[model samples]
Target: MGRKSNQQFVQIPLAKLKERIKQLCGIYGIRYVETEEANTSCASYLDGDSLPKYGEKPDGWKASGKRIKRGLYRSKDGSLINSDLNGSSNILRKVARNLGIDLSRLGRRCLTSVRRIRLWATKSNLTLKNARAFTPGS
Candidate 1:
């Protein structure tokens, strides 16, 4: 049999992809406002609605910052309690520990990467993944 030749593929523009990524990131408390253009667009989008300001900062930005900070802090502390590991820098290590895996067996070099940390935070079924974002009323 011959391979089908009528298959078609659609190409999405980078700008469109970026916009979609920005939207998804927003839902996960990641602000893509580091650049001037992004900041302007974000500001405009936010101003268009009467959304309640949780504080002097946007909830998403604050949450992302908190997670980063927690992760870094946990990396420094040997203790890995659920609260401490909520958004700690060594989240993968914490998760492994929580699961009763021996870190020594895995070797110190086998800790999870940042990308994996994000994946765990966003997709893992672990209890730590259920930690609420540091937002008001959360």
Candidate 2:
């Protein structure tokens, strides 16, 4: 049994974050297509010889001021990945905002936080799909 005070809750699903990430990347011509070098077993890419699709990135790609490994700018996509792993939070709020999600009750840790995302999608006449990550597949 749960407390009456905690009757309402919110949580962002992985599928939503995945779709939103793709939408944001799509704005810059970045495709979520996977690269051949990605590890099929783990569903993630390996630091291999080939350049990854959507540029999962590999050696020889000269990085700028950002290290391309952990720099926030280089890892803007990290916002998506992190959110996918951590669920809804302030980071998801930022990423969602970038994708025009326009959620008002962001940064709250609950089991029903996805309402605003759905609402925004509805109000904006947007059709959301289960978007894939910038990851490669078998």
Candidate 3:
């Protein structure tokens, strides 16, 4: 398939997935919020780094922690955090400001201790695999 056609095909299912997520949230009485994830991955939640708007970084702006590789982030305290978790924490920080949620007590250790789950789709069945707990500096 051509590139454009491939993207369209992918988008169709993504739209349906989003709709289904909204429906599930509604059924569970959970609020479905869509927040911009602009600089979430680039900023360090452990260091309380400022999250800049997408493409609007200030002059010489820098975060304390940085992505060391595809899946790892090096924090300011020389600790390693999962890159995905770091980004997710920053995204939560974005909405926490408006929701009055306190995240100051959150620490890198908690992030590293999270259990990772791997999901597999076999034919029409979905299987969940219990991935090992995330170890720091792994």
Clashing pairs in 2: 9-112, 10-110, 10-111, 10-112, 10-113, 11-111, 11-112, 11-113, 34-136
Residue 137 of model 1: what lDDT?
Answer: 94
The lDDT of each candidate is 0.36, 0.36, 0.78
Tens digits of per-residue lDDT, candidate 3, 96-123, equal 8676667756676667755643222364
The candidate scoring highest on TM-score is 3
Clashes of each: 4, 9, 0
The ten-residue window of minimal lDDT in model 1 covers 38-47
Off by over 4 Å in 1: 1-7, 33-108, 111-126, 129-138
Clashing pairs in 3: none
Candidates 2 and 3, the one with greater lDDT: 3
Which residue runs does candidate 2 get wrong by more than 4 Å?
Answer: 1-86, 105-117, 121-138
For residues 10-119, what per-residue lDDT tens digits would candidate 2 score against the true structure? 67697888889889889988746422322121121111112234445455654221222321121222322222312223233324534665555333232222333343
lDDT (Cα) of model 1: 0.36
Clashing residue pairs for model 1 = 70-88, 71-87, 71-88, 71-89
Full candidate order by TM-score, most accurate first: 3, 1, 2
